[model samples]
Target chain A: MQTKRMTFPGKWLPFALLAPQVIITLIFFIWPAGQALYQSLLREDAFGLRTTFVGLENFVRLFRDGAYLNSLSVTVVFAVGTTLLSMTVALLMASTVNRMIRSRSTYTTLLVWPYAIAPALAGVLWWFIFNPSIGIVPYMLEMVGYRWNHRNSGSDAMLLVILAAAWKQISYNFLFFLAGLQSIPQSLLEAASIDGASPFKRFWTIVFPLLSPTTFFLMVVNVVYAMFDTFGIIHTTTQGGPAQSTNILVYKVYADGFVGLNLGSSAAQSVILMVIVVVLTVIQFRFIERRVNY
Target chain B: MVENRPWANFFAHTVLIIGVALVIFPVYIALVASTQAPGDLLRGTMPLLPGSHGIENYKLMWQSGVSTANSPPAAKMLWNSFVMAMAITVGKLSISLLSAFAIVYFRFRFRMFFFWLIFVTLMLPVEVRIIPTFQVVADLKMLNSFAGLSIPLIASATATFLFRQFFMTIPEEMLEAARVDGAGPLKFFKDILLPLSVTNIAALFVIMFIYGWNQYLWPLLITTDPNYTTIVMGIQRMTAEENPQWHLVMAAVVMAALPPVLVILFMQRLFVKGLTETEK
Candidate 1:
């Protein structure tokens, strides 16, 4: 709420300036979210003719609904898997690139372009690589006596989606991790090295501990990303297939609402997702506060 | 000085080289696949090298898209993507700039209320509110239109906050000096503030353009018409075929990915700055 010490004296001008963003937020964002809340409390017949007010019935049904519960668990596993996988790869690359004096920019450029690829496109690329009929991975996998088909295997489908999601996200995590690594003072590493510690020991004892803040921030970001943004990855590749193994929460809302035409349940799912986002945002902001103070 | 070990440096370089290769592998495969002849991929495992048909495949896709999938030509789809991305970027930057300026420069009623209202949008992504948002578009008759494609996605809390943060760092003496020169608020904003914001605007433009270009779910939901289908969504359409033509599909993927990737590669400094600062 900080403003200039010398301020503009205006009434209508301020309103006029705020109009465009406020109007768009209301019409597109606020209004639609309001409708989701309102509709979640009501149910309509399949014909879209008769509507009955049902208080918490949709919410109750969602808790009992097997598919919704499955989606919740799938989301947990997927978010955790994506966060760990992308962050681990990104950290390795970031730490390695930080050590390079000559090839640093080249490595960063090579690693960072993937951030621009759409999640759906990333999924398609991985899907092609893992294609059962003629993919390179499967061709190689067969030589090791293991067949790979995402279409029929639930676990395989989940793994494919997770890899695609993590692959696209590695670029983002890498940029942040690299930035984090660069910010660690070189003097600390030098001092630790002067103590005759090995390179690996110095990293673990000096570098890794300092990078924890960045790691934690990326964890929340990666989780939120996997839960929400990977909608494209799942939609493009599996469509939450192989017995709903890959159906994260956001995709389920779309499938149940748009594809299945179950308005009430979808609205309820939307409300749940909103709550999840709110919680995550709060946690993110809280961490941001600590970061600022530190 | 720390002791130098040749083995440590060599190992670090090796790991970095391998990591960069792994990162580039997927797009490399897509690039190679895009060049293959139509039946080359169907015959066996995909070719690992460039084919003689690269130009032909790209020409076929650019001039006429997968006709079986009902997608428009890649040229048209790329145009739509460009227009949508520019619209979203410009819209977000202007609106966010105005709102941030208003909040920072003026003492107004409901200022805190409006700030929190914009902040609330940070939590509600379009995916969560898919049905009702689609219905709003449908009701407004904006479906299948660029306005619907861009406007709904442009109310950016992050951009607004970024501008607000930038504006606060401007010394109060600048505004006092401007006022002494008989400059009104709008003139001060135009003459002084706008010049200072060029770098921030450029950085944000890179990030927003990529965000707009890569939009998949929103465009997928709103634009059902083949003419409005973006290349990103067009790939989905192409691959949805019972037996997707891998050659054409990879060609479309390459086209879909090229502009944004080029943007990043060319304006990497701005992109990196925009990304890290925006998230912060």
Candidate 2:
């Protein structure tokens, strides 16, 4: 609510200035969200002809549905898997890159451009690379006496989607991790080293602990990303298939609504997702405020 | 230096080189596959080296896409994508700029309410509210048009907040000077504020261009016409076929990814600066 001390005097001009964004927000965002909430409470017959007001029935039915429960757990596993894999790799690369005096930017450039690739395209690229008959990965796994195929195998399909999702995200996580690494005081590391501690010990005892804020922030962001933004990756690679193994909640919302034509159920799912996003956003903003104070 | 650890330096280099290679591997495979003939991929595993069919494959994709897939040629799709990305970027920047100017420069009633209304949007992604939003757009008859492709996706809180933050850092003296010289609000906004905002605008433009270009689901929901197909969405259609034309698909993927990648490479400093600032 802060503003300039000497304000512009206008009766209708400020209203005019604010009109476009507010209008678009209402038409596109708010109105549809309201509709979703409204539709979640309404149930229609199989003919789509008769609608009955069934308060919280959709929500109750969804909790009792097996697939909905499966999707909730699938989302948690996918989000956790992606966050752990990408953040670990990113932190390793970032801390190592932070050590170089020269050639640092070269390595960073080589790493960061992957962030620009669309997730769907990234998904396709990985899907091709893991194709059972022709892909190099499956062929290599064959050499190692392990069979790999995502077509019939649910777990393999899950793994494929995770890798594809995590691949492009590493670049984003790496950049943030690198930034976080750069901000740590070199003197702390130097003193730790001078105290006869190994570099590994110094990192765990000082650097990792210091980087907690960035780590926690990235964890929230990566979770949000894996939950919502990964629709493209999942849709492209697995289509949440080999028996709904990869159907995270976001994809399930689209699938059940559009493909399954279960409107009330889908609307209830959408409402649930909106609630989850709101919770995550609140956590993020509150953390950001706390970080600012520290 | 910490006691001259030669092995450690070598170890760090090894880990980083491997990490970088892994990052580059998928795109490299896509590039190599794009260059291969159909028969070349029929062998047991994909070739690690480039094949001779690169030019023909790219030409075929750019001029005419896969026949069975029914997707338009990459040329049309790329143009559609460029137009869509440009429209969204311009639309988002312009409206957000005006709104941010109003919020920061004026003491207006209901300003806080408007700000919070916009803030709530950050919580509601298009993915979550897909069905009803599609219904709204369908009701409005905006489906399959460039406006439909861009408009609903543009109304968010990030860009507005970003502009507002930038406006706060701007010196108040500039505004005072404009006022003392009898310049009105619109004139001051146009002449002084717009000039000072070029760098910030350019930075946000780079980031938003990539964002708009990379959009997949919203476009997928609304745009069903072949003419409206973006290269990103079009490539997915190609791959979804019974027997995906991998060669042509890879070529289209490369084309789809090229512009945004080039933008980031060229304007990396701005991209990074804009990204860091906006996230904060």
Candidate 3:
């Protein structure tokens, strides 16, 4: 909230400067959010006629609904799976690349570009790789007598989406992990090594603890990414199918409202997702504030 | 580095090599698939190496996409994607710069309320309230147009915050000097602020370009017309066909992915700066 010590002399100029963003935000973001809130409290009969007020009934029903519960659990699993897989791999690669003097930038250049790939494209790439009949992985899996069909199997479909989502995220996490590693005082690592500890022991005891802030920040971010941003990944690959196994909450909102025409339920779902995002954003900002002091 | 252990160095290199290989594996397969003849991809005979049909497949998709999918040619889709991305990047940057300049440079009434209103955009992503947003767009008759594709998405809380943070670092004396020199608010903003923001703008340009180019669901929801189908969503339509031609699809995928990937490679420093500095 700090402003310039010296100020610009303006009454309407500032408003003019802020108009475009404020207008767009109001029209696009605030208005729709308000509409969703209002609509969540109302309901209509099956033929889009005979409306009635239903306060919290949609939310109450969603908790009792089997599909909604499944979507919630699937979101948790996908978020945790993506965060863990990408962070672990990125931490490993970051630590290894942190050691190399000459090859660090080269390795980084190779690893970082995937951050640019669309989630939809990443899904297609992995979907092709895991294609049952023609994919190389499935062909290899068959030699070991394991079927890899995602089209008919829920678990396989889940795994396919998870891998695709995690793959796109690794580059983003790696850059953060690398930055975190670089910021750690090398003197501490050198002193720990001089204590006759092995390299692995030094990493576990010293480097790992120092990277917690970055780890926590990335964890929240990855969760948000998995929950909301992976819509494209799921849409392109699974379409929440194999019996709605990969139907995360965001997709469910779209599906239920737009596809199922269940307006009240979708509005309620949207409100819930908004609450979750607000909570996560607050948590992320809180961690960032705490990280500054550390 | 503290110790001279050769084995440790070897282990590090091995891990990095394997990590890089895993990262590159899917794209490599996509590349190989694009180069293969259509028949080579079926029956578990997918080749490990590139085939002779690379040019043929890319040319086919670029000229006339797979007819079965009813998707437009890659050339048209890529052009659409470029226009959408540029519109979004330019829109986001210009609006955010102006708003941040307003917030930082002026003392005004209801400023805090306006700031919080802007902050609300972060709470509800396009996904959560997508239905109502779609309805709004429909009522406004923005469907299947560039205005529908980019404008709603241009109000960025992150970019505004980024510019605010950067503007805060500018020495206050610079503003005082401008004021003393008889430079008005618009004069200072146009001459002084724009030049100072060039680097931040370039950095954010890379990130926003990718964001706009890679959009799938928004375009999918709004633009039912094939004319406005972005490359990202267009490829999805291609694969949703009854008989997907793997060769042409991969070719389309490669083309769709190339622009943003190349942008990152070329402006890596700026992209990384924009990305790492972006979060909260």
Candidate 4:
């Protein structure tokens, strides 16, 4: 890349323009992250006031705590499950929509509507459908002589959360994948077809590789979203219930800090979650970046 | 070899139509259930058809404390949502636009560093920072205030990053031309850059608005009082107590979800355009 030389006025203007954003982000974002880190080191007394530093004690407690371990496993399962399912479905949808000759915009718009719905509302929607007595799907299942219960089992609850989270993500990943698909040159696919390759073969050999970059980007984003964003549904539906089967790291953090008032433990969980996210993201970038042509 | 296969096209369309229907069925169920009476809803006998109890449900929802001494009115909660969303939208847009313009249009030391700093924040979800953010709001005495709800979210790294990328795409010759015509930096931004970035601004505005509208946890945490309850918080509150009113809760959820749905429907073009632009 060529370095463009800047005039004196140009040199100073950008900093001035960026100052407000920098200041605001530092105050609100960086400061809070710092506070979370600092608080993680301090032990809080019963009255919600920090009294002394207990370095590494919180982490030790977290490792020894069974509930914390369960929640960590749940978080991993939820994040991985939702990401895989959502990305796969999104890729399928994107490919299908791309193949269509008409109503592409309509299909795309309808598909993306679920993304517009609040996650909280999506939870409520699923809650109603899965309601044991009044929920239509569950009731229909019972009527058909099948027992379907989400509230009574941890695995069921996890499945519900995964489904709701995955549903919400479909539109987002679809939108990106569609954009990625659209950017691939028509000539390449036509040339593959001309060489007597089937549609499936063309997609596998040509289109899939071309779309890998978008797929990788969506994977990182989808994983992050699953880890962080699905708390609303968890809070509303499960509250990490059925003997804490559905409790994830983020929900555990919220429960400990806000509801449980165990700020130290919450902060500790926060640190752990952050570390995991950062490590995973670094691994993703290192490995996937090489595979992404772009 | 096959230029146009009707059977293949038919099979593809059939599969896609089913996929699309599956995608939208849940939302359709929600809308239908929203129109039913509590009795019908509880019985699970509510037909898929629109019901006569739409107004009744709305009335019950309003009386359920979305409005009054006993309950906050649904309309008031909607208004609260609108106010908070609009404030966050405007604040995020202006801050993001200014920052983007500055980063792209001006050259400064640590520019790339600042970009990465902001970009990294995009990955740090509210879950990780909620505890500290709660403390900040409590310390600021902004708890239960709209400012507390809106301010923390005003500077979105994603928005800033997107806008900066978009601003970079603007031809430098325009800015140079304005500068040569004796326009200062501010004038150049306002006269040349701002006008050209309207499409981006519109797309980002809708996206940020939807984001603010859908925010659940932070607002739920900061706004302790019912008076400050946003639509999402209100919906959560509806289910928090014993003997939770499912009908009223569903109604609230519907009302809460309406704005973003309507915005997306009306601005579908801009929504896609915005996402595409951000990727670029």
Task: Give the Å error, residue B155, model 1.
Answer: 0.4
Give the local distance difference test score of model 1.
0.92
Q: After superposition, how far is residue A45 of candidate 4 from its true place, in Å?
A: 3.9
- lDDT minimum window of 10 residues, candidate 4 chain B: B62-71
The deviation in Å at residue B259 for candidate 3 is: 0.5
| Model 3 CAPRI rating | high
> Which residue pairs does candidate 2 place in steric collision?
none
Number of the predicted model whose DockQ against the real structure is largest? 3
By TM-score, how accurate is candidate 4? 0.92
Q: What are the DockQ scores of the candidates, in order?
A: 0.81, 0.81, 0.88, 0.55
Q: Per-residue lDDT of B80-192 in model 3, one digit per residue for the tens?
A: 99999999999999999999999999999999998898888988889999999999999999999999999999999999999999999999989989989999988998899
- Identify the runs in model 3 with alpha carbons over 4 angstroms from their true place: none
What is the C-alpha lDDT profile of model 1 across A186-229, one tens digit per residue?
89888888788888898899889998889889999999999999
Q: What is the lDDT of residue B60 in candidate 3?
A: 89
Give per-model TM-scores: 0.99, 0.99, 0.99, 0.92
Using DockQ as the measure, what is the rank order of every candidate, best first?
3, 1, 2, 4
For model 1, residues B28-99, the per-residue Cα lDDT tens digits are: 889999999888898867788999999999999999988999988899999999999999999999999999
Could you give the fnat of all candidates in order?
A: 0.84, 0.80, 0.90, 0.57
Query: Clashing residue pairs, candidate 3?
Result: none
